[model samples]
Target chain A: MKFLCTRCDEVMKLAGAQAGDDTVGLTFSCPKCGGSFAMLTNPAETTLVKGLGVQVGGRSEPAPLMEVIQSSVARDTENQITWDPGAETRLANVPPFARPMARKAIERFAESKGIRTITAAVMDEARALM
Target chain B: MRMYHEVAGDGGSDILGQVGKMMERLAGRLSLIKSVIAVASPKGGVGKSTVAAHLAASLARRGARVGALDADLYGSSLPRLLAPEFIGANATRGEEGLFPIAGVFGVRVMSLDYLTGYGARASVAWAGAGGSITRGPVEASALRELLADTQWGELDYLIVDTPPSVGRLGDLTALVPSLAGVVLVSAPTLLAYQVTLKSIERVRALGVPLLGLVENMRGFTCDLCGAANRINVEGEMGETLSIMGVPALGALPYDQRLLKPAGEAGPIEAVERIADALLAKIGGHAAARA
Candidate 1:
């Protein structure tokens, strides 16, 4: 079951059972922000979720509760570029429309650098430590 | 009530009920995962992560589906510390919870260190890590995310490594709504013990049970004389913890090899015998309760 909550930051669990035909909608109150929202989980295909950072009025605000909870457990914020003054960009936090672009950017960045997501230095450090 | 909630090893579901209720409205399901263990220290360099990592690994080695949360967002070391190739992996977001990065022997790891590209570290130096994603300021935020999205796959334990200072909530082990207990770690130094006691007091307010005390870097044996003296004069300082109503879990003597210039394979397992004994205690407690 895939879904997102803004206040919650990431995936919150789906409580109800999967019903027959077409789409499955599960609802829950976010454990993080204490807000309520519904999730659409299908046995088929991925569910593209809107991130918490993007607000309804087209302004960015705290996410729905479910997203925060999901983000916490699954570590949705693992990929992010943070700036010195204070701006951090994460693919998960990016708007749904931007995910593909973000993923591509990450892929290109990985390729151009001649290093995969896991860095050579970290791998080297691995040898030294082990 | 006998105020049973105040003590660790009490084995009552009171703590569970209390924390569970706090997160109740938020968690959509029964949350099959039981026992969220946070390893914390008010001071850094006390081997908090080292102990927590090994505990997770040891638990997994015993056949439990174990997951390790490298909660120290900005300055995590678990990725570099684990051996072979399962060193580190970042968490992936999902509706259920954060799917942990796989580590050696099937142990799952989640860390922000992996989130920022390895080069992100360089960028972070140029920029900043967007505040202390470390367990300090972001405990509440992180805990919520952990519970909701992590793909733990029915694990027995979730070992969280917290930064030295509690930060926002201060002592997160206590402040966080859900947790079985807190494991306090300290070096043999008197200063370490003093800090540990203070940290424990902070959590006492949250009423979290103190699992026990672990004294790391206790001593280095004199190979020639066999007169095992602690790493330094401050090493003999685990006494206050005993007086404070917290049981001494184990005393890990210092070994230079474990802390050699480059070696970092998990504090040498501390005292295997003590670990086995402690395991027995936990096992017996679980079985008796079961």
Candidate 2:
């Protein structure tokens, strides 16, 4: 997408970019008027752009293939929820293929209740809620 | 309001140039492989994945370097069908790209299942406005990422197991510019034949070469006496093939042995036959062009 500077009737150049938790801020400057403009993207737009497997500003080094997928998977596991041994055992009962989703669901449940650690009792409660 | 001059190379982000570079990388990766074929069907439960896995195995058994890609994001069964033990296994990532897991007969395999950490049941939710949205673009981009990023290296053949949908097939064809051809799989039922015809039309519409159709589950083969028995009523598949001007590659009788895990037994004779015919067709097409 091209950005046009209405004040100077000149095309804007991407000056810089900053990535946030769920948003991306892009700064552009008009060469003719020396006017600066900044645009922020929502989470969805950020994801859509990230899905393109490209960076906002040109990268210093070439990105490895499947970087987006690798980062996304890593991000999913970066949450700080801890699982008790009993809860871990219970999670083992879930099919290996579904364990990731089950863990995510349980963690989300725990976080909703402001619980940091997931225990067998918490697992049972989450199961009951499900 | 004054006239707006569309400046060239306005020193923007150049997102389109990056996408073009990505495509160039994809093309470079594909160039190492001689043939890239997709086994596709329009509807599910027609044994498309089975055909794809066995086809790769069959080709690999014949001393060909084969790579199998499970492009079925939602219903990726090739991982289990090709390497059951590797199910839920994480893909090995190197500094350059992700490496495909070695399956039966040394056929390298890659699937989204490995990345998702959930085998086939993984729900691929996309981030959209306020909630999840339809996943057409996401799926396509994922496939493009897979095709562009996987360290497939050099191979004689790369068999892609496409999802049971024409849209996915189109996405794959568009993603891989070096696609050798496509093999459509269908069962012996009327519904399967109807859907297969639609897939054939879609393939032709995309202008990609249609290798042929494999009539999977044509009948059941009795293990005791080795007698082939017709399971479903034969439909107008033969007529449809003639009308569509597509060749009858081979008929794969439903064998219970295929249900057995990979490496327990080799690909059935019918699968081998399909593989041979596929090679011949691809060779013939290339020769004709040359």
Candidate 3:
């Protein structure tokens, strides 16, 4: 089967597939743009390539790509949150991995007080609440 | 007929090997959005899209930046609900990324209707005829990219309107693990309520917060006699959801005025009422965040 690059319209063929196998790895550099794209195939292969072309920096080491990806996923399990400048500085006391959770806690604290902005005082209150 | 050739060995030979990396990349791209909320149902015709569109509009109205992401790949209705002009065209692209089309009240929107090249109107026709652009795991991954690739700017809220399908819900949860919450939309009918309960269970199993349940089209009002009566559906929906620990957001009565053309003004009053209650909870949660 063939898959099209959603960005450059470059077509890449799938490596031979075994019968009844629903999944397959498809990778190709779109000659048109010299950008790399990869995917595990499914019936809707076209949509999977949502205009993303991984810009390959100079290839030196075969990255433990999967490992890097796994670590990122594990980290993302914690919510990424926003913070006001004062509140963010206050979060310096919190651990890096725990900052996201702390941010959420602070926002909730602010919301309770009908506070839209998270100042240092709000952060102090949030820390107590948490 | 081949415009391009396949590389013999590049990247990973095992196609399934890239799923994790793909998901990781996607999550990284979408990290900027503050809150991700999905409006879902277990069955169709439950007014899920209407809820999502109006909720987003309401959020935008409250002086917060907002975006509406239509995740219904097969039957996208956000374009029509929010920005009808974008119905047959693709969202414009820029050097930064694909710009989400600004719709009514400045709400950014991204949908398959704006992404597919197959004339958005034509695609809807095909979807209505029981055709889909893709299926299975690929569909899930595609949705991840859709959300990741759109340049939503700094949004305070992103309302994801999803189709009523088990697989579609899986796709959303897989892509958005940090989702703030999910609002299950259902009619006041027993059948709709039961189906919504199953959806609530699935969302809970995934660990995404359940914001609440919204009873859409709750009761019909008589125009002539000004009489209000609950729809023939029988069930204590609020009590049912409350038993499961999910708050009832409030019911939106059916209104015939919604069927009339509103044009550029966005969704009807019914949807807006639900949106108002939802926003209050969101606001209250921040104040009462545990």
Candidate 4:
């Protein structure tokens, strides 16, 4: 696949998924003014899988965090949080503190990239459980 | 093989199983990029965002898949620095979410400013009341929401720009799993330098790696050769940095070319050289990955 750099208009071949995410580096310098620029060599958004974990059911479980991204998936994905509106009741059974953390984590999952808020929630939830 | 419903209608193990599946899917996306480095400083006017933008740009220039995210929720400066000229309210409107304004060079960019209608984080200040921004004390979830809403496509580096403070709070960065390091920007001013040290130690205490230190506006430069020597000054910036142990990335002598845009007028387009200098110190791939 070919990825066109938005900066230099340089067309570099997108190395295969197996080739590695570091292969495609950015080079942005305007040939005219020597104004160079660059961006990261992104990975195959569709084919790759990043690990995400969250505590659930009294045990820490791996959670699917930010998934389904494309050159197309922009910040708007938060609007589609897909919260099971009534899930609040199910969330009730969780401890008062874990409930909040769970709520926040779920909201984060619905809104941003994956697992951004887990470290804190996991700790807080672990503490609450204990 | 357990199927979970996206709707709240059902409960039981199905919910747990479904959540697991969902997290598994989301993890797939987060895995694409190994690190999201945020450069920050607590006191404003210390060039925190400037260091962040340039470092990110430099990394991108060096062949890394980088996404420059301005997370200084209240002080986002990347929108203007990266892609200015975008005046439409729906400028970031896209099927996915807010679209980062591509700069003179394309670095997949996004800022909280893009989500709310503004060029920087100031807009969100009024828009999101004290506790209503999203939910919880952890802002990373809101950041994640911002990330989920935007179309970042893909990036190797997501160099985040943050408010100079103690740390982050979302599921992604705010609550961080791990970090490559934290680039704390400071000046030679004792107060700034001390705070920078505190931030460095704090991040390390939290387990986040300290990439190194960047002393901005270290001193003045000679007019003729542009050498960064503190003119008529008693001590050098690097002299004090030695005892700190953290690698002094380099001292940015008050370069008019570099400081002008990031000053009262805000990020100017002529500071690419500053970006280059930062990238060089980041060590590129040559710096053995620990």
lDDT of 1 by residue, B124-158 (tens): 12121223332222345444454444556766777
Best by DockQ: 2
For candidate 2, give fnat to 2 decimals: 0.29
Clashing pairs in 3: A24-B15, A25-B15, A44-B134, A108-B286, A111-B287, A112-B287
Give the per-residue lDDT of model 2 (tens digit) for A51-123: 6677887766666667666544422444345667887778767664355456667767887998877899999
Tens digits of per-residue lDDT for model 3, B1-290: 33434533343333333444556556665777878888988889988887777777767776778889888877888877776644544444443455677676778888766544343534422111112433343345446656766777788899999888544677688678777778988888788877888777777887777788888888887889999988757788777677889987767778654442222445566666666777777776656554
Which candidate ranks first by TM-score, i.e. highest?
Answer: 2
Clashes of each: 47, 0, 6, 63
TM agreement with the true structure for every prediction: 0.58, 0.82, 0.62, 0.54
**What's the lDDT for candidate 2?**
0.77
Q: Give the range of the ten consecutive residues with the poorest summed lDDT in model 1 chain B.
A: B122-131
| Proportion of true inter-chain contacts also present in candidate 4 | 0.00
Residues A43-91 of candidate 4: C-alpha lDDT, one tens digit per residue: 3321121112122111234322222212112333333333232454455
Clashing pairs in 2: none
Error of 2 at B25 (Å): 1.2
Query: Model 2: which docking level applies?
Result: incorrect
User: Relative to the true interface, what fraction of contacts does candidate 3 keep?
Assistant: 0.02
lDDT of each residue in B187-247, candidate 4, tens digit only: 7676776666666666666665566667777677588997767533433546555676666
How does residue A83 of candidate 4 score in lDDT? Answer: 28
The CAPRI quality class of candidate 1 comes to incorrect
Residue A85, candidate 3: C-alpha displacement in angstroms: 44
